[model samples]
Target chain A: MSAGSPPGVVLDPWLSGVARLVEEGFDQLDLLTAVDLPRDGVIEIVIHLVRIEDHAHVFGHVRLPRADPVLESVTSILPAAAWHEREIHEMFGVEISGHPDLRPLLLQSTSGPPPLRKDTPLVARVETPWPGAVEETTGRRSRRAVTPPGVPPEWLGEGS
Target chain B: MTQRCYAVADRPEVRVHIRDLGLACCAVEFASAIARGLLIPAPEEPGTAAVLVISGTVTDALVPEVVRAWEALPEPKAAVSFGACSNSGGPYWDSYCVTKGVDTVIPVSTYVPGCPPRPEALIDALVSLVVPV
Candidate 1:
């Protein structure tokens, strides 16, 4: 539960620890965010508390059951945490139970699964990586010529 | 800085009022061109002499906005698909939100191709607008 270095402990349910950190004079919520670990079937939420006066940083990690993860909003403790909570709700699909405005942040008005989820497929076509072989003179074989397999040649010609 | 006016009566170097519809990285180049005086912002109200210069990976959410802007520009309006994103989905062609191309939504007069076209390259496209054959 404790941080890797300095000194800290991972609170079972960060809701209370968020309050405890505020009580200990860590007035600034440096960052509140979550990560999607599909392999673990959990969303890991991490909150960082900073005391500018002492330049102390305390990071707390909490894992929620990805199937139906939920957590109390920390906005009550740190209003600034509201945006980050909303971000996690959308990106990691973690439910911030008491968030006043869980409305979309970076994702404009749209509905879909969290884009950050490990399993979430990239919706955009990435650039075709440069092929390692220098001279790939177009002489068709089984597949297309321009880009190698796995790389889309959609960007190759005037049209796909 | 080049000036272009598409006025039928006066043709006083028509100002290029560009309504930028950004989808991704190319928006940066679009902004830079504006800084170089290659383009100008459209008036507060729609239906002015303008071009809907779309760049980057456009998501499905922005289709209606593009249509609305294109319809609003006063007659003699043109569209410039300024990046790979708009010409095709660009690299993001595979994305769920990215629209395959701008031509699907509106007529494109000029197509500037690049992952994110450079400011100078965009100037070339803008030049095509301002300069007459």
Candidate 2:
């Protein structure tokens, strides 16, 4: 893992390479994440896969043009990656082909374009402060916090 | 004999705690107590323990670093995802670079929820670790 170099093996004919990885049974899909490189006009999709025996990881990268970034979904082969892929798509606007359900995993209908997109400005919102908490100097309010895909927010709180 | 108490070194204890929590590494402040050995290694006894307190943005990019740090310590430890980032990824959750929670990369035994948990809360989590499930 060199500095700034992407993780995992670089396979030519990217889509087929991922299909081969799937066939090899290194199919435990750990995570699907993306990086937005606005300057380059592309979004880099990173797929993390693990070997069941020792949890050895292999990453697969696909560079998609920002204008029409799309890739085949691995959900049919690895169900666990479904939500993760959906998250990447919702956040980065990278379309996943062959996905059974391609709906917004996060973001309210009024929230405008994909917030994680490189071009999106970091806007602040204004909201009431909690009791006894000091008011923030910045007028912008923070985004509402949401529970992670698998865990509940209450589970991370006191009672749970 | 009079008893004396010293602050434990934050880095070493954090390393040990991560292992117990089933994490591989962490990004910590490296408090002087950890460097000075005030925080003794847990005895060889069956249920020895410690705590790993986290705050701010904890994402996938930081996972490998945390894992590497945890690998350098001995086992039978426990972790306390002591703040927002450790428990829920805090303000960074929606961002592409942040992870959902430390639990995504490492196993967490207890979550001490707060933007930054009180030191007393951290101590309580450590006590619980030694007391058994």
Candidate 3:
């Protein structure tokens, strides 16, 4: 664990260690999220926990292989973690192993890849090209031919 | 070729009861127009309205719903595609979530052009639509 991380354990003893934390009164699961690193070939699943008795908090995480990221569900200990697990699965394609109901929690459609992955395709982009200068009607200076963003030059140019 | 034209003052209201289906940024103006009585809100009953006013960017997911709304209106019905988005998807023409133009889904009697057409222009459209072509 980093100096900034609270009392936590590595993947070596994460579940049992956190279960022990629950006994010590860190009873609330504050957050469960993931970060995808395509370059490093690992997807990091981060979780934050809080002790309701005195507001003590800690952050923990486990890294999964990027090819098929998967993690055992924590809902057996913190049932509240279910929705967050489902969201992470839907967004980042992280399979939450042993989830009772791993169905879609937010999106109704299932036509494309998980949306939050860094590799997810963009449906729309307005990257217009910078045209070379042409003679200006005002004669002040040559100016680039302007077109609306997202429109390609071929559509604006004369002839097919 | 020879042509003939006819005109008649059929309905006493001098206007078609407009059934509005506004989806995005243009909904605010549609509500404002309805509240101001510039456009008569059609009754809930199907096949009663004479015009279907579509304003805003409609996605492919909502295309079937739009067609259902159009089919609900009575015969001799006219449709107005308002704003740039409905005309050609405005700023999101290339977006997969946005339909390129409303005409691809429904026949249009008139198209009002503008990102969000000025209120004066909308009023002018209303005046022109008062007489069916």
Candidate 4:
């Protein structure tokens, strides 16, 4: 953990430095996750690793610019990173260089924009009639009718 | 012996609970019937047939417990992972407390795909596995 940061340590020189660390120290790459910081126009990628004895569990983070977020793939260094990096790429559109295969692991090919992107708007869920149920349109806003429980009203539709 | 079964809609019941709890720490109530005897045996049977229902905070330590429980079960059993927390490890997947998915610990067969799948869906899954085609 870095002195200034909350609980995470920020790696300098970003992807390259982290790749070197993975190569030299940790042989096993456990997992990879990303945090979208749209406010800063950057995405933070966290890489976790553990040694054989599980004594040394370390994490490294790299921040990529949102404009063209790209980083070196650690799949070569650690094979487990393949799916993790693919998920990150699909969700955030982060480019991973030298990746043996870079494809959308989760999202469908025909799906619209990335759902997890910070700027992408969330869709509202509409409850239609089962088979032949009538569509009820009252004086109330269509947004409210389709709004599912627990889902934010704002994300449902435009404010009426 | 007699068996009792309950059914609930996947839409309103399951999704509502999942939303209430959030995927991070959602808890799905397992029908006591299934939990009483479901077991995960060894990996020798090619495809380990056992459903590992998971929810709440899944940790690395929890993996061993699940594996041990599964290993103790009889052969030719399948796993039905109910709830988002169990299937994809839910909101806590990326977090430090949760594993990405329960599959990391034990093999999974069917993923119910909800924070908590409706009782009806759970029943359907159970029936599909038990009832022959």
Winning model by DockQ: 1
Candidate 3 vs. true structure, TM-score: 0.57
TM-score of chain A for candidate 1? 0.72
Q: A97, model 3: CA deviation in Å?
A: 2.9
Per-residue CA lDDT of model 1 for A43-62, tens digit only, reads: 77888889888898788777
Which prediction has more favorable TM-score, 1 or 2?
A: 1
**Deviation from native of the Cα of residue B18 in model 2, angstroms:** 31
Error of 1 at A130 (Å): 15
Flag regions of model 4 displaced more than 4 Å. A1-8, A125-160, B1-31, B34-133
- The DockQ-based CAPRI class assigned to model 3 is incorrect
Model 1 chain B is weakest, by summed lDDT over 10 consecutive residues, at B1-10
TM-scores of the candidates are 0.68, 0.44, 0.57, 0.47
DockQ of 4: 0.04
Candidate 3: pairs in clash: none
Using lDDT as the measure, the top candidate is 1
User: Each candidate's chain B TM-score?
Assistant: 0.75, 0.60, 0.76, 0.60
Sort by TM-score, best first: what order?
1, 3, 4, 2
Q: Which regions of candidate 2 fall more than 4 Å away from where they truly are?
A: A1-3, A11-14, A125-160, B1-133
- Better lDDT candidate (1, 4): 1
Local accuracy of candidate 1 as per-residue lDDT tens digits, B81-114:
9888899887766676678898998899989988
